[model samples]
Target chain A: MARTAGSDGERTEAAIREAAVDLIARHGYEAVSMRQLAARVGVQAAALYRYFPTKEDLLFTLMREHMEALLGAWSEARPATTDATTRLATFVANHIAFHIERRSQTHISNMELRSLSPERLTFILRLRTSYEKELRAILRDGAEASVFDLDDIGLTAMAVIQMITGVIVWFRPDERLSVEGVTQTYLSMTMRLVGATTNRETQHVHAGTRLRA
Target chain B: MARTAGSDGERTEAAIREAAVDLIARHGYEAVSMRQLAARVGVQAAALYRYFPTKEDLLFTLMREHMEALLGAWSEARPATTDATTRLATFVANHIAFHIERRSQTHISNMELRSLSPERLTFILRLRTSYEKELRAILRDGAEASVFDLDDIGLTAMAVIQMITGVIVWFRPDERLSVEGVTQTYLSMTMRLVGATTNRETQHVHAGTRLRA
Candidate 1:
């Protein structure tokens, strides 16, 4: 009996998180009320409070989980090889796949940062900085090894993150392009942006043209 | 006396618009109320309604003007030369400059699209498509002229747009990097992403290193 009740509690919490992401994504965090969220979850407002004492807690939980999931994804996708080129390709692919799968959560994570209190906002930003730091390390290593050409590691890292994350803004699983195809093209562009030595081969495959070299 | 009244009315409207952007950016559009906005602008609710009859109307106005201002800025910044590289650089520079100057409006413009009525949403999207089309043309011309190597013109255009428009997210007029400096670096990165030949020179200057070629 206790096991069943615990399972139900877990299921309810999961449902609430999902609904909260959707609602907050549609309506900004400030505009979404706990009452509305409770109704959407088919739970009593009192029960909702039992789980999340405050609405800001719910928003912060979503944002934190989004970042944590992203970090976890990257950890799994991180290649064992020391080759910076391969590492970068993996980073881009992992990022795109993770974000594409959770579009609403990604939207909430990106758009609702303003709603987080100063301390909570700092926590989120720290997580983000840590994630971005991994990319910077890759860029820096590639530059040091003379495999990737870069101007400013920090700026390049930011540009790549923004470009890839922006994929969720327009990408839909359609006939004309699959996630694999889009990831391949973005990989090529990113390789070129970093002046990676292997970019010629990648670009040639996508452009369907012979390189001058 | 009539001229003075007209000017006063225009000033009041401008104040309302500015306050709206700030409020909406700080708190999401759905969370912001006209009463709160009027208080911020030091006006009565009725006076606020005199300029914008509905909250959605106010939102649409802010968004429409943001896009129009962007298009206007691009038009003025559009160089006469047919050189795709030059045109692309100009577009990136103008976009970065414009968005950095209007960070709050840019945020509202990006985040508040969900709040627009369907018709207003379509209108705003059409304006966006037209602006993006200009970049597509440049990419197409560059690809045709063999000046810029591209895999997919459409994907490339979106990637470039996202990469440059992303400047407003983190960039500030700080002592570490000025607007000109950041724009120049991004220009270099954009050039490389498209596989432009001139990227070699730009990369050399920024990287402070010799290229293999």
Candidate 2:
């Protein structure tokens, strides 16, 4: 009976965190409160404290989970045979796919990062830095081999992240541009940005879709 | 005499807004308040309200000004040259220059946009859409001219904006990378992203300061 209760409690906590992430993403962190979050989760305000000591703690939990997920996705997609370009392409695609799927969580993590304590924010920054560093190493190798034409790998790495992260800013599920389409579009841009010989060609259209002139 | 007094009042209000932009950029928007803003401008909170009715209004006004400045800069630097490559390259360089100079305003505007109301938020969204539309038009033209390779212009435009906008997330003036260096780096990536063939010939470690691989 106790085991079942603990499992239920954990589930409830997860629900609360998810609700908070959604609202905070839609609204800013400063605009949300425990009462609002509790209402969203269909739980009483007092009951939430049984799982999270404070709103900050709940937000922190969400951020921690998101980071782990990002790190995991990148690591899982990486393969031994993956060259730098392919590795980066996979990384960018997976990231855009994840952001499009869980935009609310991703939005919260990116915008409200400063709300955390200095120590906690530093820890998160390190994870971010480490992630960028790994990509930079690949970029460095590519530049050394003359496979890419990027001037600064650091700047390019940052641009890759920003470009992919922007998916959360305006991407819509109902849009005609499918996830595959967006990913392929970004991949093409990224490859060209890095100076890959993307010689394969596609027919040109003038003033057709907003994507093609 | 009355007109002179009005002009003085306008100057003070502008100063307060500038100080608010500077502070909020260094710190996130949530950490700012009317009281702190007034203090920064050497005025009391009550006096501050003569210009801005509320803290949100002040932020909104600052955001509007910043957006106008961005649009203006883009308009001013737009070369008369019809060549898609030069126009896009100039746009990329001009965009980076704006990002570097007004880093703080852009940072605060994005972070606080969601904290605003539906009416206010819609206006900001319009500002963004128009900006995105500019890139979309340019990319579409470039793709038609075979100077760019992309499946979706909308996605490509977002990638470019996000890549540039992402700089505010980590860029620091105190850092070793100069505004010029950052500009060059972003220019290369953005140029490549847009399928600009002009920048592809530039080699690594070219022009002093080996842009860290």
Candidate 3:
């Protein structure tokens, strides 16, 4: 319906989705409407209809696309290192970065997932399952290789995802904390939580040792 | 307003509030209605007016009371202990235990805070501010006493609270995991997160230590 063959149409559609995301993230999905979105986009209310058939469809579109984008970012940033510890750390660091970079997209995508249609809900869960599977594989491999200490690797992987993804709700880009610093903080915290003793344990044992410049 | 003099009326009102908590916690706050609460309480919709004046009033009442209860719990749990390390551990452990015991209450308290009237909303924020003041006092004391090595104690406290609170979304008491085990795990993770070392940290420092006991 959008006639999205040209860049102009695509741009218009993108604008609608952006407006939808902002409005939903601020006021929640149920409180958002196309007329409000149209006004925000500086378009006629009917113009939005060409792109999104209904308000719910618009929200669903935003969530589906956002989730896919998140999954895609993970797939893209995956390093080639076969070391499970490095791979898992990279996975978490990349995830924290993605959540910070696209906070609004991630926020609405998470909060509005409960309002999605059954089929779309299942689709989103499947995507999440794939995402979880990738993380679990690295964790499973780590546990097997004696690099990571974990019980029920699947649950530990899920908990790690939850802990990292939970960062979006509170992280502020304009704050004093640098992304690198926050990522290292979480990496250290998670390593200890999962009983990974390689670095943190060594540091604690040598608490009196000064770091080499 | 209907008579509030009798215990019968008080019991009915309490029942209605409990039902609202359950309904709203299962669905979101927006999706629940007075009629649904009435149905859940097995009473007439009009009779609900005998207790609370309006739908929004009921929501505000439940959320306001829940916050007060959480605040009360924190106050009752805090002891005048000499050791900052023991005090901080007690606080985090008690916070986790409260949530595990009343996950539904915390869920409602969080989800419905946005739905409060501005006047009631102030109470919510004031309550939160007081809670933070108390927690930060411990963190500051710990930092000053040389028991904690946190660069940003306030930010660290906020992160720890958010991380622990976020656990409610995923924890299941019926699982193979015990509540004590989960609490101990989180407590250990938290102590290590704040740079506090323990026997486990020393044990884990050994290169060949097994992960599980």
Q: After superposition on all CA atoms, what RMSD does each candidate show versus the true structure?
A: 5.8, 6.5, 6.8
Candidate 3 accuracy as lDDT: 0.70
- Runs off by more than 4 Å, candidate 1: A1-7, A199-213, B1-7, B199-213
Worst window of 10 by summed lDDT in candidate 3 chain A? A204-213
Per-residue lDDT of B4-29 in model 3, one digit per residue for the tens?
A: 33548778888888888777766667
DockQ-superior candidate, 2 or 3: 2
Task: Tell me the docking grade of candidate 3.
Answer: acceptable
On lDDT, the candidate that comes out on top is 1
In model 2, the clashing pairs are A206-A213, A207-A213, A211-B153
lDDT of 2 by residue, B76-150 (tens): 777676666666666666676777777778777777786677898889888877877877888888888887766
Show the colliding residue pairs in model 3: none
* Pairs of colliding residues, candidate 1: none
Model 2, stretches more than 4 Å misplaced? A1-7, A42-46, A144-146, A198-213, B1-7, B22-46, B54-56, B199-213
**Judged by TM-score, which candidate is best?**
1
For model 2, the local distance difference test gives 0.72
Q: Candidate 3 — which residues are off by over 4 angstroms?
A: A1-7, A33-50, A54-56, A144-147, A196-213, B1-7, B26-57, B111-122, B138-151, B200-213
The order of the candidates by DockQ, greatest first, is 1, 2, 3
CA lDDT, every prediction?
A: 0.86, 0.72, 0.70
By lDDT: ranked, best first: 1, 2, 3
**Per TM-score, what order, best first?**
1, 2, 3
